[model samples]
Target: MTELLDATDSQTAMLADLVDSVRAVEETIARLSAVRDGMLAIASRIAVDVARQASHPDQGDMAVRSVAAEIGAAVRASDRTIERRMDAASWLVEAFPAVWAAQGAGRISAAHAQVIADAGAHLDHALHREAYAARAVEAASVESPNRLRRIARRIAEQFQPRTVTERHRDARELRRVWVKDLDDGMAELGMLGPAVLVHGMHDRLTRMARTITLENAQATKASTEETGEPDTRTTDQLRADLLADLVLTGSPVGHDSQTGVLGKIHARVEITVPVLTLMDDDPGASGSPPAELDGRFPIDTDTARLLAGGVTGWERVLTHPITGALLAVDRYRPSDQLSRHLRARDQRCRFPGCGIAARKCDVDHTHAASHGGETCADNLAHLCRRHHMLKHHSPWHVRHRRVGDDRGEHENDDTNAGRAGDLIWTSPTGTTYIDRPPQQNAVTFTEDNPP
Candidate 1:
């Protein structure tokens, strides 16, 4: 017994030491990233300065590209990627000094600093940019990069003199859809549009997919019992099928029996509003912060109000004024109460580093229900189908850590706190990573309004 205890003690100490070493390594990497950004920023300046000194004006762009390509070869990276890095580095070091400084000091990760720089890029005035960075960097220091994105955007909106509505209107003119060719004879189709409309279109497709999935499940059960074959199409596959059918035939595959030129389709999406913003006499007035769309990004208040007015049913969610925690939600669809809460809580896939929106994810049981895992929030999470399958079919394991678990303490911080529901994922190699629930940074009332 004594030898066994000693062996366990030694193992614990070794693990603890490894954890400390990993933290140290992460800090060192952050510092190195800062140094690299500084060097890239200087390189960008040199390239631009040299190009400006050239006699031929048209050669300026080519000159810069030549410099980027030269550097890219030395770094073993692509010229286009290096050129983008140069531009990003220059913007970060020159425009958002506070964010750059934070990154250099290892107070924030490079991803955090980069997103802040990106969010504040449109703040043309030095003073306004400085003010935005000061607040954004503070948030970045504590928030995960994903949560920081939303916070940074909201912070930037406050600093911008123009209202979101004005920007939205101007941006609307540039809306478009395009296709990009891919390997394996496949292609990716993308669209850029107003946030509400884009999300609404997705929601409509999801609704149609659910309908098709239910019908397929019933048919598959009857056919499988007789013929020993089942429909193996996933929800994601169904959604894709629905999208293609709707685009090509003006209705879903089996739903083509409708009388009209196009079959009826409706979309449902959750939109959270600051009570005050919705009640404001002038929502479009400059300085009013934007409403949140699906808890992922900001949308103009005018659109939020318009949707609220036209919708037949809407849930009223009350969140804490200070902590931004969800307090209560009035039932609009009582049957979907748990699902709605999960979507709002897990704004994206629970898989570490994945940003696929939660509405599109499968509500998976962390512990297999077949093994007696209860069906509840603690046991449930939104996982993109990819990761959902990975958890079940691969050696990767996942579970919700208990409150006092030592692993839980390391992952909980004010900016990323959702400990009760956070997941501890273990890889095939026995390494573990905690994926904390993203901070529910609700759009709230701010004293500063747009000019």
Candidate 2:
């Protein structure tokens, strides 16, 4: 194996040797991936066992949380993500033995197996699962995931015989919007719904922003900020402005007309700016230290000032003179000091991968109150509604222990100290995983130095 990596052997020997080495590595990766999938299959069985045991109140240790809680914590993955993998694994083993066999033989990768399993999931599991699996796997060998989806959809349409309108109606029932925080103080808003309706909205926005011409772009390039320039907006800029205009002011959309009704859109925005930066009075400022927006994304000092001017009666934020503790808000709906600290410290759900904003989560007792859990920071952590209920109703247990200097814990770090404390989650299966609080700090990265 070590000889395979030797460039001397590859460079001096026939090219076929190098090709063989590459194929060896690829085969090893495929086999490892297949083994992991097999483990996932075992996990799915454990989930079912835990779920069944928990459902029977007579079982002592097995009377635990939902299968998702146990397996999800054990794997340190999102509950939804684990559920999908389990569904894929279980479906392949039970309904599509041929595809699973192919995967085990390394003829198809794990991804290919999952694609085949997921594509046929909507079929009638009882009567048509075998039929669907047989058809889907035949194409799986010759097709990619995308093509498999098309093949499965075509097969499903034939077997189920649903009208296009009926399918559209069903798809509309699953419409939702979600937020994902990005690395650079930005976030993406994802909209999922009827494909045609969503795509049409984008098409309309694109058409509305198509007024920009090359001539106008050229004229604006030479124009200074001091000089009045022609409309030099790019396609994206125009589309954004159009969206803002329509939302902020109930204006009509598109060149002709749009499909949706307009209303006065009310929004709440929070920005925290350092006092000196807010006043533009900081002399040491070089690249303008960023301000916190919505307590998540960061923005330039100029953007902060602009937003500050637009809002009415901006709230003043104060910090402790020494430790930078957020001063108590005596006037702003007072609450328990510890609860406030917990809320701030846990900006979002504290579960391994759940990101529901903490403000929207329930302050859960790490140990059951009935089990003598106290209402202190160390005994508390934010769990979103689903997980909060999950912890209590199932066998999942949460424990918190200090990991760093107790005296140096930040004021907002109380619920768990963003990184100071270790929160251990024990699955029904008796596996433990730790969740670290989210914090922001500067990091430096340098590429390999050239020779």
Candidate 3:
């Protein structure tokens, strides 16, 4: 009974195997039929070429249009197959230097030889020769042409420049070393990009010019004294003294008015505020009435009034913690919450490649409102104007973490998060990439975590 059951089970298994084999054979037959038809068309076109060659004996043996068309059709029919063929040719050239050299002597187009040349460019000639031999041996051992071809093409591309512009730029930079020092510096300056470097140079020159002007002014003052006129304070020195006086002790006076002031006014005038001090009442000191404090101290009335207002209204606009050159306080109102958040997140712009601080950035909406995005904290990101514009207008996308996710999950998850959302960039060649989030440091952290 056991033997009979075993035989029955084997028979069933054999039947199933037979059915699978038949299906596979049918598929193969269909493929072959297609190939046969394509080959027949190619042969017909080749025959036409042969006839053309015979008819135009003096025209030189050029490829006939019909044959070219057929070849194009074949390539279009299977681009992957054509790529594999090219790859195979490349491998053959690498494996046999003599063959490559013969081909380079004008037997093939540069494109055909490039694949091999590129592969060899990655290594010293001797090592490349060895690699080619190893590849040949591997192909022979495996009996796989496609595998060998794929490996060769990949190796070639590893040494080839991805674009012409990159190659040209690299060559130019290499040649820069032989240039004159000033010329080399200028070239480096331009390489940094005109807009950035020019602005920076302008600022630096302005600072140096100001320093020179101050020095010249002081020297002029010394010369004038030597010539024996009035030894008056230099303009810069006088300005400095005035500024110091205003900072130390100036006060503002308010004028009563019913209606709000309008329009603009310009005027120049000067006023003096006497330095006042309380007198010490010492009966033991026998002296005449204490000399009056100097009452001829000159002050700019407009500046003094402005300073007084700043002292009185300081609490309303300026916070104790916020210290530095004062930026426009009003312009910052809309993004105050975002500023705080950015401080906590670290004040840097939250876009990869951007290091601008939150204070120098605009609060951008990760998900645009036109696309039904909300204006919540989770949807906001700090980005400098340049990066913000890139995100909004360029082929770049941004994504921020959802409210519920833990901070760690979002921390360096810029690409993944962007993919999960509607944010995805289609590159120029139609390839897609996710724009990464920016890194944060102390400034960004404080901006993100503002109290």
Scored against the true structure, residue 421 in model 3 reaches a CA lDDT of 19
Give the Cα error of residue 101 in candidate 1, in Å. 1.8
In order of lDDT, best first, we have 1, 2, 3
Error of model 3, residue 357, in angstroms? 3.5
Candidate 3 local lDDT, 133-179, one digit each (tens): 44533333333334445665565445343554665465455432221
Alpha-carbon deviation at 288 in model 2, angstroms: 7.9
1 versus 2: better lDDT goes to: 1
The CA root-mean-square deviation of candidate 3, after full C-alpha superposition on the true structure, stands at 28.0
Residue 309 alpha-carbon offset, candidate 2, angstroms? 4.5
Rate residue 10 of model 2 by lDDT.
Answer: 47
Question: Highest lDDT: which candidate?
Answer: 1
Clashes of 1: 2
Lowest lDDT sum, 10 consecutive residues, model 3, at: 288-297
Clashes of each: 2, 5, 21
Alpha carbon lDDT of residue 390, candidate 2? Answer: 68
lDDT of 1 by residue, 1-451 (tens): 5764656777989988999999788777888999999998888777678767865365455555555645654454555677788889888999988888888888888899889988987788999999999999889878899999999999999889887788779889989998654543245799999999999988998888888778878887667366655657787887888888768656555645546434565455667767667888775473444577666666667778898899777776666665566655676556577777777778788866566779889999988899999888889999887667657654567888656655433332234344477787665545555677666645444346211
In model 2, the runs with Cα more than 4 Å from the true position are 1-24, 53-75, 125-132, 155-158, 211-227, 244-265, 269-289, 293-297, 308-339, 367-379, 399-424, 429-437, 440-451
| Span of ten consecutive residues with least summed lDDT in model 1 | 408-417
Models 1 onward score TM values of: 0.48, 0.70, 0.24
lDDT values of the candidates? Answer: 0.74, 0.65, 0.42
